[model samples]
Target chain A: MSAVVILTPAIVAGWPTIVAAVAGAASALGLVVKQSVKQDIDIAQQTQATEQTVEVELAKSEVVAQNLAKEKEIVVTKGDIELSVSRDERGRCKVCAKGKGKTKAELKQIAEQFAQKMAQCFVYNRVATELKNKGFQTVNEEVMEDQSIRINVRRWVD
Target chain B: MAQHDVEIVISKTGEVKVHIKGVKGKGCLEYAKWLSKIVGSVREQKLTSEYYEPEVKSKIDLHQQLNDE
Candidate 1:
């Protein structure tokens, strides 16, 4: 062993990268990507009459974009519960969960869960891409019972 | 050639634990720096005994033995 390090992930990427991560998180959670446009949510909010709405922000995230209009949001759904992921005005990633029948606490919990899963997916994608670019070959990759992702990679250095 | 290995575990909440193996001297630190930049901020880090070993000594020794034959 040479070293052991613990890191906390921060998401800093463009809209396309964030969308890819959102797709990954949605698939992991069995949620469907209902739409990729923010206007869809605006219309749904007007018609759905949601009883409880909760917003959770990823603590360490920044959506870097050259054009403000390109910062589009994504909507994911699992039954009646809907999650809208977008970059807030402060550049932080935000996840909003709302449903008609669920309580405020329930919505909050779901929002938080989605936020964490999204962050996990984001970090996994980033690390895997970087490892491949750095000429490291993956030896093994697996998901633990607790849903954590483990990746082992090796490289030969002369 | 030296084989450098890394084991990365990304927790459900996106926290990462990285274990670097087979790298000697400051080369291990270079890996650490690259991973830190990719993932995020390093919360904690520890260096193991292998990090103090001479990086190319083993390979050089192998080359010298081959040349003697």
Candidate 2:
């Protein structure tokens, strides 16, 4: 046990990274990666059949054009549910999900799920990179009691 | 050697919850930044008592370590 502090999240990633995050988020949500920006949405009416769309524009984003393996845009769709993740003109990543047979509330839940997973993947990658740079040796890693990740690292400062 | 543990769970609806433990200081922020890049924008972050400790620096350049962010 060393020090712990909860931080105020600052959004500073470009579109490419956001695309990766979208893929991660999609995978977490059990959405299959069908194609890039082209999904087959087959919403069913039994689930209330209402469609909703949510788009969040990153305000303090600086898009980096570097070619990273995770930079490609990822599109996922399952059944009538469809999702597309891409960089906006301003380079902020955007996520959209639509289902025809599901209620608006259901679709909203799916969208929010995607958003959270995306955030989680992004944070996990960023933290790992920094720890390695700081020379913290990883002793153990695992899923913890509260659905969070516990990473053990040690380094000698003296 | 310290243990770096990351627990990633997707809820029934695909919402993800991440808990990072065992590291300290500003170094934790780097992890947070990297994950935000991988996942999406961060919605919330809580630094426990471990984050206040001093960082243990090895030979790796900060740039190389933080580039993932």
Candidate 3:
């Protein structure tokens, strides 16, 4: 009753954190992690020349390179669609989707969905850690039918 | 002791909506600021009557008692 606020999440975290979020999103979307490049090894080149490719960049995000090599990518797959998540040269989060027999629009939607899910997982993890450190007790938590997460927390202040 | 309650709803698209209850005045703003820092920039904000109310009811009651005396 006191206040209401709407926020757009900005993803700022280390490479490990980003990878964790990517894993979480992949699991939620029923995708399998095909490859995880933790070191500076050369990633495998795209083998599908005729596949439609779409890239979706997350806004207001900064993926810090702490413990990250010059090149790190997480590749996931769902059926024929392949999604690769990585940080661009500018340290921005990007998701690239490629699938044969799919249109550009379809690939774009798949990339965008993966990006959004990754962001949600990142925000949830950050908020949960902070709330616990701040002595807030979680009173209730649930996932809605729309895949949204709802959490209620309380604390006593002197 | 004052109990502060915060409800956070994170949408599938990663957008967040926060509702703070049982907090008044500047205390409410404190929660809002903390949440915004953890989440991201605030797209919109609204303050209700509770936010405009006195922060400490005990202090107001004490002041009224002194005035009556």
lDDT winner among the candidates?
Answer: 1
Error of 1 at A142 (Å): 0.4
Count the clashes in each prediction.
Answer: 0, 57, 0
User: What is the two-chain DockQ of model 3?
Assistant: 0.79
TM-score of each predicted structure versus truth: 0.93, 0.57, 0.90
Select the stronger candidate by DockQ from 1 and 2.
1
Whichever of 1 and 3 has more lDDT, that candidate is: 1
Candidate structures ordered by lDDT, highest first: 1, 3, 2
True contacts kept of each: 0.98, 0.21, 0.94
Worst 10 residues of 3 chain A by lDDT: A38-47
Stretches of model 3 off by over 4 angstroms after superposition: A38-43, A66-69, B59-69
Model 1 ranges with Cα > 4 A deviation: A69-71, B58-69
- The weakest ten consecutive residues by lDDT in model 1 chain B span B58-67
Interface RMSD of each: 0.5, 6.3, 0.6
DockQ of each: 0.81, 0.13, 0.79
Q: What is the C-alpha lDDT profile of model 3 across B1-69, one tens digit per residue? A: 889899999999899999999998988889889989999999999999999998878543444345654
Candidate 1 CAPRI grade? high
Q: Candidate 3 on A41-133: residue-level lDDT in tens?
A: 233343456678899999988888634634788889999998988888788889999888999999999899999999999999988999899
